[model samples]
Target: PVEIGGGDVGVGCDERGCNLVDHHRVGGLERVRAAVASVLDVEVTAATLLTPERWKSLAGSVGSVPVNLAGELVAASGDGTSVVRFPAGTAQVAASDVVDFFSFPGEVGGAGRIDRQRDWWKSWMSAVGSGKPDTNLPALDLDVIHLLGTVAGGRVRVPVGPWTGGEDVPTIDQGRLVDLVVAMFPVPIPQAPGLRPTVRLLNGTGDRSVDSAARQAVLRAGVELVVVGNYRSAGVIQTRVLHRDPADQPAAAALAAALGGGVLHDEFLSPVTDLTVVIGSDFRMDGQ
Candidate 1:
């Protein structure tokens, strides 16, 4: 079909309520509508779905792109079929192009969970950098991964490895770290515990206790455990360096040293989702 000469190509997750400054008319999508209408040779309306191909093609023309606070799209040329779409990745953008983008905290740069975050961390740890406790070693790429589920009362699953659903424990095969991140909304901690703090664990599927005597084992391990689970999916167990907590230590590092560079801290980050809106005006091909 036809293609626009210059535009922005940025990655975003949500596309329900985003901002578009300098790219389109503020609070007026007429410019965007007109641009798409001219390209499609159709009447402009407020309902459309620009496919990923279209966005990629538009972004390919530019050098760098803007994601506009993450997922965002809009309708232009009516029939609800012709619209705008945004994808996540390191794409192209124009020097003068303007695109809006945003992303959630738990989410990563691209898709699904923060798999990239995990990969990046593994790389960062090799060189090392300065962090809060400030060391000359490369900084660990610590980030949050969002699996589907509530942290209040429902059960959460996390896989303890680089992969999302797999386990990397040296001894335990197909092992999983399932825990309920019990919310302390109503009850706040009175005082920090001097000894290692312990939380309760249930089978998640049922209230049955698997490890009745199961304790976190180490007092303050270097590894941080996270539990992630969605409504329809099973829970997953994951373990990574406790970069966020200053006092906390990683349990895996000691294990990694003994394993001789075989330690598996996979540095994986979870992904998050969001809904954003495209704020701009219609456009005409002739205008550009």
Candidate 2:
């Protein structure tokens, strides 16, 4: 049980003492999955740091354009996966909704404004108020559930919360958190089918922090960190995840997702390693 407690959120101090607000952290679900996958020796097929930007980029990469309905973005891929996103509670909740949608993408009985100006639940309500949504027009956006459908290979209902959050977070229940995260995977993630992917981490940024962060993410993916060193050659302005064989593609994709998506390629430097992650200066612990 992940005992939730402590000064995880900030109690901003001032002349009027500390103002306690319900502060929460968005994203990091992929990292949670990675940590659990590593500990449990399970291999997840796909992972992505789903954000508006990521959704847009993924749509573009898959060669599709998302229609902006007021503020919500919607796109249907050739693979039959439709991507919808709108600003809302936190990343996990929205994602869960998406997973639900994929299980049953209800037809748009009515359309609502998807304006970027107003995003929160209240604003969403006001925008679709009265005859629009005074009763229950429709849930505008939620792609996380759709993603879960993709991950689970079926429909599922999962709840997200501000478990252990904030910068001063060190005493968090890692084991329990991992348990919760593992549960989020389809069924309980099973043990790896074969040996975990072998990974080579190259620190192109020469920043120890970058190296350390990359190392952690790579390890969290349940891969073999076979080699770690500095990238000797130049021109690596951005992080890149490369794989030598088609088989390692999933592992490479998982690593890239853990690192918040980066340049990916098939370098084909085979017989040495399955995947290579070159840490560039652009990489950040915060997916900025």
Q: What is the TM-score of each candidate against the true structure?
A: 0.17, 0.34
lDDT of 1 by residue, 1-288 (tens): 111222332233111122233225342456555544443223334433333543333333323433222332333456657554334443222323222221112233343223332332232222222122123211323211011112212332232232232211112111221121111111112122323222221122221232221112211121221222221222323211222222222433452232122223222322121100011112111212
Q: With candidate 2 superimposed using the best TM-score fit, by how many Å does residue 123's alpha carbon deviate from the native?
A: 52
Worst 10 residues of 1 by lDDT: 271-280
Off by over 4 Å in 1: 1-79, 82-84, 87-89, 92-110, 113-191, 195-288
RMSD of each: 24.5, 20.4
After superposition on all CA atoms, how large is the RMSD of candidate 1? 24.5
Candidate 2 local lDDT, 1-288, one digit each (tens): 121234333334221111112221222455444443454455565554555554333322213212223233455778989676432223222322432222222223232221121122222233233232312232224454354224333333333332334322323445555544434432233445336677777888656676555666666556666778888874467887888777777777788887865746665564576788888766776545
Give each model's whole-structure lDDT.
Answer: 0.26, 0.47
**Model number with the top lDDT:** 2
